[model samples]
Target: MVADGIVSAYPVDPEDGPPVGISKDDALTLKALMSPVKGALGYSLEDARQLYLKERIGVGEDPRRHAARNRLAKLFVRAEAGGLPASTLLVDLTRQQARDVRDHMLTYEKPGGGKVAPASVKRDLTIMKAMIGHAIREFDLIKAAHNPFEALEVGISSGGEEDIAARELKETLPDAVIAAMRGNLQGELNLIWGLGSRHARLSH
Candidate 1:
């Protein structure tokens, strides 16, 4: 059956002097044997590889490239995951990616302080998505195409209203979290961010 076909593709020992391949007949037999169990570990392949690498070939693992996510913020995380049990480096990398997406969104405006064009909106979202994707890949997180600013159909410069911008930014998290790169809330979508200095104050 199909089970035997997958098993036949399993890597085997090369030092066994070119051992006989898992024949079609044996494949059928293995298929019948595997029908009951699904996705079973056929053999202890991991231990064998480690042993072979240690005994037959001793090689040092690379350190430079695979060390951190970005060279600029390498110090933010650390060379080795210290305090954190599950790879602190990975967590740090994701945080930095989130920050970048925020910074990109903040500065999205024209030189003359006009509205942000439709082109710019899509571009900024794409850039943010690319960074987010990198983090997702690193830690293996599920991602969706849901837009936090779904109602934001306009492109306007935030620098125009400095005071309101500050207030709106704070209201994003309510805990003074100035770096809310991603948000997914239902009802009362914190319109402070979308409005300028005039709408900065909360309606009584």
Candidate 2:
């Protein structure tokens, strides 16, 4: 029976040495046992996050990277504690789940009883989205896929916008104009540049 086959897949002890050189029939039985449950669609979020952390640490770290890893770890720990199973698959994530997490991040009190900051919630959501995207790409977990994070509307304002703005400026603004916009521009100059950017977008 399939149950018996799956049960047989478990090893007995280290003293017995590793299981190897099994018969082709036994190999097939083992593969069937190890396969994901029916309807299981993607890698677990816990596994994916760990993979992301592993890759980041592989490149070594400076202060900023270390801080980022710590922040992300805190989020994952919080998520698991909030009843999100470590076994929950990334592809199973919905907008409702994303919003649930966002709401928790925004309102949950710390061990000191202080509420989480809006900025911190925003930053963590940004990191969460990027982490999911990176994990999917790196592992080919999904094929020809729609990213759950792509459509997530985490109500925070600042998350991921810096990267978007940088890309937009690179594509739309000339090098000389970009250089000129640097440093402290007076209020008038700021308004002028903002209006000019809007105009450029409309013209394009």
Candidate 3:
């Protein structure tokens, strides 16, 4: 029987003497340490995401890029509303659950309406993969263990085909129209426009 916050453990051999009493806190700590999940107690996905963003900021990353990454990171927390419970500790997250997150993003709908594009879904997953990977390395988790988000194939179509199709469908602007637009632009604006036009020409 148990009393207070102490648990009794008995040895198989009667010659080993009386049962040992362990406090619940010590027992929980032992369990957490022995569990294969890894990571420190109470460390969660949201915590990892915040740390990752801070690291990026420290490296001089742009605010806009940080905002974009934050949006992607929030999807994991939002997933809890869908019953995924992504706010749990990294150690508790399984490969199947990671795949489920990918599926959720694939089927996610936009605020204005319509489903998210597959390309965008791929990008989101890629960003998440990086974030999780960063957490795993930064936390100094089990060296032999692989990250749950690693090598998940987003399976997006090749960009080459899309680019070719876009180019084929685009209507070329006439020289007169280009001349008129360029003429209305100011000094710096005209230089920027010229550079943009040159880059576009070079791309083709």
Those runs of model 1 whose alpha carbons end farther than 4 Å from true positions after fitting are: 1-109, 143-204
Candidate 1 lDDT, tens digit per residue, 16-90? Answer: 732246674555456447542311212121222233334433445555423322321322232122221122222
Which has the higher lDDT value, candidate number 1 or candidate number 3? 3
Ranking by lDDT: 2, 3, 1
lDDT of 3 by residue, 78-114 (tens): 5564355645676666788777776666666778876
C-alpha positional error of residue 46 in candidate 1 after TM-score superposition, expressed in Å? 34
Ranking by TM-score: 3, 2, 1
Per-candidate TM equals 0.21, 0.53, 0.54
Per-residue CA lDDT of model 2 for 1-204, tens digit only, reads 764654467664568754545664554455446554322334668877788877854445688778877888788876666556566766566666666776666667657766655656667777778888887788676562345556555444322222233345556668687658844577888888778877877866
Please list the residue runs of candidate 2 whose C-alpha ends up more than 4 Å from where it truly belongs after superposition: 1-42, 57-61, 109-114, 144-146, 156-204
Identify the runs in model 3 with alpha carbons over 4 angstroms from their true place.
1-30, 33-42, 58-66, 82-86, 142-145, 156-204
Model 1 C-alpha lDDT versus the unseen true structure: 0.37
lDDT value for candidate 3? 0.64
